[model samples]
Target: MKNSAMIEACLACFAACEMCATECIKMISADHLRCIALCRDCAEICALCIKLEQRDSEFSHDVMQLCVESCTACAAECEKFAAHHDHCRECAEVCRKCASECQAA
Candidate 1:
């Protein structure tokens, strides 16, 4: 994407989400299931948004909107586990940043 900040944010968010999902999967409790799903969805959406932006697709803006929503949702989910999970805290931070960048774009 031409917007470097948004692009970087998305990339960072994607990586964070992926890492958080892996950590959640390794947990013994079922409480992490929802967080895992949200992280996975957020990661995919962030990646897709990056690709769409790179291609300069006509629907990129629309896709970006969805990306923002996904990030927001992921951030909320991650925040619930942030107190105990360092990965979730990091993921939530990145997702929030990405969502802000997407909204600005």
Candidate 2:
């Protein structure tokens, strides 16, 4: 059974991603915008997957795969922008961890 901790962590990550994405979108430079969008999408998918896993839904397998891939992509994108932003670095670390966990699912 998925515990509350996993969900909480994922939710926190989602929030961080959203915040980072929003900040990136407002920047004058367009460099990190795509990366930020990817991160936001990845975080959202992870959140959905976590919720499904907690419910033990039959669709959890498919959702987990999607979430894992999204996180992997997000982590890669974050790595590209990490040097430019601390939030990107932080998001990358979290996304990597989340990717690993999703892969295990």
Candidate 3:
């Protein structure tokens, strides 16, 4: 895949979400549980965005819209825990960047 900024942001968001989910899963709490679920969903959506963007799929634009929505929700979820977990803060930052890129794309 070409290293466009959008692609890079999406890939970074995927990695961040995966890491955030892993970290959240390690904690035993209701908030962590919610974050874990959001992170997982965000990771999957980011991965889909990457695949669709790479192939130059006709439906890529539609997928990007979904990606933006997913990223926004994930970012909000992450922000809720960002005060305590560094990983969540990092994930939120990446997700926000990815959402912006998806919108621009």
Task: Name the top lDDT candidate.
Answer: 1
Candidate with best TM-score:
1
Model 2 RMSD in angstroms? 1.9
Per-residue accuracy of model 2 over 3-64 as CA lDDT, tens digit each: 55456556666876787787777775778867877977977787787778788989988987
Per-residue C-alpha lDDT of model 3 across residues 28-65, encoded as one tens digit per residue: 78868878988899999989988988998888889899
| Per-residue alpha-carbon lDDT of candidate 1 for residues 1-105, written as tens digits (9 for 90 to 100) | 488999999999999999999999998669989899999999999999899899898988998999999999999989998898899999999999999999999
Q: Which ranges of candidate 2 are over 4 A from the true structure?
A: 1-9
Predicted structure 1, TM vs. truth = 0.96
What candidate 3 gets wrong by more than 4 Å, as runs, is 1-3
Q: What's each prediction's TM-score? A: 0.96, 0.85, 0.95
lDDT value, candidate 1, whole model: 0.93
Of the two candidates 1 and 3, the one with more favorable TM-score, higher being better, is 1
Between prediction 2 and prediction 3, the one with superior lDDT is 3
Instruction: Pull out the clashing pairs in model 1.
Output: none
Off by over 4 Å in 1: none
